[model samples]
Target: MMTYTREKNTQLLISLLKQHGVRYVVASPGNTNTAFIGSIQGDQYFTIFSAVDERSAAYMACGIAAETGETVVISCTGATASRNYLPGMTEAYYRKLPVIAVTSSQPIANIGHLSAQLLDRTVIPKDVAKLSVNLPIVKDNDDVWECEIKINQAILESCRHGGGPVHINLPTTFTKPFDVNKIQHARLINRVTIDDQFPLLEDKKVAIFIGSHKKMSKDVESLIDRFCEENNSVVFCDHTSAYKGKYRVHYSLVSGQEYNSIITERPDILIHFGEVTGDYYNLKIAAKEQVWRVSDDGEIRDSFRKLRYVFEMSLNSFFLNYVGHGTEINISYYETCKAKLDQVRNNIPEIPFSNIWAASQVSSKLPDHSVIHFGILNSLRSWNFFDIPDTVTSDSNVGGFGIDGNMSSLIGASLTNPEKLYFLVNGDLAFFYDLNVLGNRHVGANIRILLVNNGKGTEFRQYNHHANYFGEDTDKYIAAAGHFGNKSKSLVKCFVENLGFEYICASDKQEFLFQIDRFVTKNVQDRPMVFEIFTNSNDESCALEKMLSIDIDKKIVRKNKVKSVVGTSVISSVKKILGS
Candidate 1:
């Protein structure tokens, strides 16, 4: 039995959410959202988090959804508050996560003229949302049932349509205090199953590309791994896999020249999941083949220019039902490729004391079943290069989102799963971008942070623009006046300490190694810790560029040698010698 009243519409909203299995809400509170916040203040069924930055709040919801495979809601006030969600919403749209944005808008009458904290909110996120509904203001008790129905429909649509984000706009006057005792047996909808199947490949080469499957069940993950092993298929995975380390998944196969070569020699069938593949061009080539995409949500469209089949089912279920445990001729090919991959892995030069090395070292030490929330920009590349531990799950808004929501997302992740060892790896610039996140220090003791401070925009030196525009003077570029160039080491320590964090900074390799080892091994009081590693901006940039150049040269020489032996050496030999 359920109860409802006119004045407690906000409470009804919370009740309806619990009924529909919403476990988390990332919200930016304001006067407009007072009623909603009051209703859910002490509720046990949901965890409501407050983020100072609404954009980060939205991404935090997306991050939660990415980990839970459930719709996470984000709430903000009208006007610019709602607008701040664009970046995260765009990411959710592309990544196909179930994020619901619950926004409060101005009254309908004052929408057009200049009203405080008001703007054109009607069609702001039309392109991104799977469904956008403007809820009618609740003035009487009779509107409760209608509002509940619409909310249910929107949630159902978000989940059923393959897990994309949705939006629900509630005007400020919509909340009328309501009684929880009056509503009885409101409504419940049964799950609807969809038919999903794929034809077996009898004599075709097959490859599997797995993206960030952050929320996939362990059983499903094992099923996929077992199927791939039995079939002698090539497997590629990103940082999100919990079993990535065990299956010998190719972490580098998604990008670079190697990816291009793999795509050029197209396989007969390709099975893809998670968001975009690392390399766009390789994906383009793979899409030309008979691609079979398996996803629980039906949101995956054949936009990569390839599609033979779309299986709308859980990846684990599909693999268990259709794939057989068989090893055939492809075993030899798989072994040969594995050998090459091994060579590449073994030949990777050891990184010195720099951001890249630090990132790699931290990734190696990451605890099993831990969540790693990374900042955007350069830190992303470092993690992408290193072999992330299977137990260390990760989430980030890699696409351009204005705010560095990495820390906020970590907060939400920790709140959702307090038992797990959660860590956030961020650059100094990113840390300052959302430093206010620490203002709301609600996260428990398990949360940790690894802050990389290179003094300035260390990543910019790798780009040609810096080289061409600023010549070889990297420090000059670093010292340039702007947002990114600011170095606030003292400020960082002060802020973290103020937030009750056990803050420590290491300026060299030995100190960093010592601090990290001590931090991970020692049993300290349960509190969040921040280890800041100070590194040289120029050295970090140089290391990556040098590695890339060496790789390019090796490929050129190898290709030219092949051409020379085959009497096709005219242009190839010249290009190789000239390093073109």
Candidate 2:
């Protein structure tokens, strides 16, 4: 048996190139290339030729590939030796020749340590190479898989999709042996965007999920509905999902249910689309084995922690082609989900007066076809449980999930539609943090702010939150309770008055209800508006707990199994639907 390179990265490189069907490798002499060269010398599958100069070897590979219509490999060691191939690689790139450059180097960590023969090749001008990435030092299976994908990506760029030269910077530990025969097969990775054909999913149980999203176009919505009906799919929507169409499952109503029951019915293929969600139940999806992220920006949003495929495409295009190519099933994943969803809708409780509770009561009062933005943490989670009208769109800056930008983001969104009423609900911490933007001249009358001034971050008071472990210590630092002084005095009253706008300050539920209708409806003056409702941190936490869990028989309990009369009815219906 012929001995091949025992090194994983070197073996990976060789196997992937072979997998891509590269027969010619023009090599220049160097000590770093010993393992790769020695391994391939015995392998008659490759047509290896030696050239003294690196530049000559590159041109030779290009000439061979261009003439034979085959991908050719150019191998060189580190330092100025690889730099000499730049001119030839540039020529090959412009001519669209399939020339792959494998530049071997000593461990990258030795770069700034004054090590001899050090060379940095991270920067390859776009004109010279289509894509350039280094094979990082492999520590585990993930690293190996990443290297395999990167190598395959390089291979794809070199030989397919308008062929061009691609650079692979290989860093070596130098002691890897050239004595193992028959390297492990490399995994091939492919990129599918809106421009390309999609991967089929006939046998897979596909689950489409939407986070906080702006209202999608009718075309996108119709395609999603048709696709769900055609496949064994379920679209999971929280209040933030914004997809109020057929086959939608509101999981937040039952997220506090049994975890096993939730995962048992969960789809193996989870397709995550839209923006960042503030749904804690959404985190349960990380349990799946594979997650396919769908985004138009070609981003790597590995939120579920099991990202296998990234479809860089719009939501409309992805589903249209996804369902168009795959086999449609007569199976019903929706009917069962719908029955349980119906039960959850009935269990919507009357929460205590707090930030979320107040918002839940009034979120419906905001006129249809308006824009609403939520502050991060509590505010986002609060509104996520309630349904927004299909015509009305909402946004939450959960991307950064910071407190300061909530008001600013809502204000910025209002600028686009100054004619529509813009409502923003946030706590005192967020309200005070962004008070400066309230005085901006650009602030318009179309904005209606539902400021839930709870005076501190009550999120710390929830036992489910990590900060709650600190108990009273949390108030001292984490919650910043009473940080900006008690809400006894009007903080933004003078500010709003100065800006030529109406300001409503509600200290109790009666005052809030009395002023809320006007706050939602009376934005006629089109001046900047702010509504401050005073709430305590305790009330906010109590309402949040009650909102997350349902009540029955006048008894409040939070658990996987709810046994109250009404709870029993809901649980019984859910279990019957699940066939449990």
Candidate 3:
């Protein structure tokens, strides 16, 4: 039981959050959140952490949510503070994490005018939060019960419905101190069972398309695997795929002509879980079918594409109850897909110093229980190609491309999980974009950064326009791509030193491999450690081309206006692909 009176609503709110099992709160202190902060300052139920920038605070909350599998709240003042959370909110929305944003604003009377730190309090970040509620200020003692009810509803909606973010806008007047003994805790509602029945499949050719699933509950994965095995289905898991089992999983192997032929001959049923259907080609194929989707939230749209069935329940729960007793079907399609996948993996050309190899090697060296925060870009792609250890957990919001919020997110994650060793793997461009994040003086020594600097956007170089735009001159091309040219190494060293980090550089394959152990095992000196690895831009371009050329079964090809597929001209194609 929590008491609520004038001047103590904020304390009551914190107590309610603790009761609901919120372990952490990432906040940026202001007069508005002072009472809330003070309430949790020495309390044992939750750890209250601060970030100078609200954007970082939100992302930090995102990381905490990803790790703890619990709702993480972010607190900030109004106006720009709310706006700062937009990028992280977008990321959280797509990734499907429960990040509660508690924003403080001016009183209702002061709103709509030129009040400081006041904005449109009603408009929530669309699609970002499952529920957005504006709590009424406790102007009189009589309003406390209503406020308590709203808070309870907000918490339940945020966690129960799809497990995404929620927003609770608290006006300044509600920050008043109150007695903690008078407030009664709201009774939690019973979990609702989804009554919808899955369509019966009578000896139909069905396939399970597994997308980027992260931190799936064990029960969910086991049920899904049993369902697939019983149905004699093929599962196509993407790079970020999380579920693992000894089922007849296939489909990702079929690429190029084989993939096109299989999709043209559509299966009787297609079931999808998580985000994306592996790649563009798979998505295009799935779009043609009367698909069935099982998700926690109703936000899983068919992209205006109609679905045969939509089960809005936890995938694990749905499968365990409905799919466990289904009869097993035998099909030759599974064998064909597995054969194709084997060929693709076997034929993938070995590249000495490509991003894929780099990712695989680095991941291999990471210590147990290391939390990895990778930037969105080629760095993410590289990690996607490799298998991350079970001990290593990452926030899979790489969907927020070109938004340099991961650095701040990593810093905040390190703060929250202080005992765990953390690593941030980012491209040079991503590092440059969020350089301000390094300004934090409280960064822990356990945080290590591996900056894979290929001079410029090596991922962009895979297109054709880049080569055409830069011509044959290497210097001109590097400069056009925003590389520091010969000064890249110096710049990195200077930047690391300025941030009080121990810096080391590796320019070639031998040096990179040689210094990796030192980079991974070396202790940080009161700040984060940075390992700058240098490689040729052309090498990355060539490696991607080789990967694309492999005769896989499910290769998705986008028809560009300009078609050129020669090894030498691949660089031009890369530039064109990246729109460089």
For candidate 1, give the lDDT of residue 442. Answer: 81
Residue range 131-170, candidate 2, lDDT tens digits:
8988977788888877877887787778555689999888
**TM-score of every candidate relative to the true structure:** 0.57, 0.78, 0.55
| RMSD in order of candidates | 19.1, 7.5, 18.7
**Quality of model 3 by C-alpha lDDT:** 0.66
Residues 1-580, candidate 3: write the lDDT tens digits.
Answer: 4334444456457657867777788879677766566556656677878899988988898898898888988888866778888889888888888888888777757876788777886877587787777776665654665565557666766676467888888776644454444444432222234764556666677777666666777677677667766776666554455655544342432432332355533566677667743243345446344566767774434421434455677776667764656565554566667665566667767775766667757876777767777766466655654455665666544454454687888888789866677888877776777778787887878878888777666655654336436544543545346555442768878877887888887877788888888767734445578888877667776665665567633334433313334453786778899999
Best by TM-score: 2
lDDT of each: 0.66, 0.76, 0.66
Instruction: Specify the poorest-scoring 10-residue window by lDDT in model 1.
Output: 183-192
lDDT of 1 at 16: 65
Task: Using TM-score, rank the candidates from best to worst.
Answer: 2, 1, 3
